[model samples]
Target: MATVIISALLFVFVLFACRSAWKRQRNGCCGNDIQRLKKVKIKGDKCRDYPYRSLLHIDGMTCQNCARKIENGLCSIEGVCATVRLDQKEALVRMKRPLPESLLCGAVAKAGYTVLKVDFLPQSGHRSL
Candidate 1:
């Protein structure tokens, strides 16, 4: 009788785990059921307005919602505009002034993503009028 009870408990535990996994798969890996945030628009007349640019390779982004979350978080910072590419798992960030890599990483972290690498691009030749 004890062995039968133990087996039943084990079966119940497995069933619960499977249900949780199915829910996650239906919602998303992040398990965010709420609607996605709106895209943030970069406020600049021309690309030259943002002289500094960086490419951030991020991990733990499983869907478009995750990408938007990271993009919105980065764009909320002053002098920063970010666009996340979900397929590439990277974000292209443009800033009016140079921002420290730590700050960029922190912003991504706030959105529950990990920044694996940050590559600062050289300033382009375009000059703002």
Candidate 2:
């Protein structure tokens, strides 16, 4: 009787695990069924307004929702505007002022993603007319 009960419990556990895996595959690793996320608009619309720019290579972004989450996280910072490219697994981040690398990494990390690298781009010479 004890062996039978143990086997049944193990079978139920396996069933639950299989169901969870199916959900992840169907709804993405983030488990969000929503296809699109609400766009996060930055204060400055023009590229010239942001003098500083950086590229972040991120990992663990499985879908558009993950990209949007990372973008939202970085854009939440003051003076920061971020656009994530899900296919490339990178983000182009622009800021009005220079921010520390730690801050940028922290933002991505907050969204359950890992920042593998950060490359600072040369300052843009374009000025607002």
Candidate 3:
């Protein structure tokens, strides 16, 4: 009888864990950050010249979904567009004008990720780490 009770408790614990995971997934890790990104409008490009670009090294991404979340979050910034590579754990961001490194890092942080490094990629020269 004790064995049966222990088994039942184990099952309940497993179920609870599953439900918690599902909730986190549904919320997309950083729920408020995702929502804020969704509401942002893409700023129009006034200059037809070259766009400023940056490369970001990120951490704490477990899957492609995490990459997508970061991409979406960064893209929401004004005058910014991003491409995230899950395998590389990096993001290439194009911006209409130069933006502060802190802003870039903050966006990733809001998405429940860490920005390990930010590199400026010049259009004519090699990347600056």
Backbone clashes, each candidate: 0, 0, 0
C-alpha lDDT of all candidate models, in order: 0.85, 0.89, 0.78
What's the true lDDT of residue 114 in model 2?
100
Local accuracy of candidate 3 as per-residue lDDT tens digits, 1-129: 999999999999999999878877776554323434443344665322326888899999866568877987998887887878889999988777799999999999998899999999876323322
Q: Give the residue spans of candidate 3 off by over 4 A.
A: 1-8, 18-50, 124-129
Better of 1 and 2 by lDDT: 2
What would the TM-scores of all predictions be? 0.77, 0.86, 0.66
Rank by TM-score (best first): 2, 1, 3
Runs of candidate 2 with Cα error greater than 4 angstroms are 44-48, 125-129
- Candidate 3, TM-score vs. the true structure? 0.66
User: Model 3: number of clashes?
Assistant: 0
lDDT tens digits by residue: candidate 1, 4-121: 9999999999999999899888887766663756777667555456889999999998887898899999998888978889999999888888999999999999988999999989
Candidate structures ordered by lDDT, highest first: 2, 1, 3
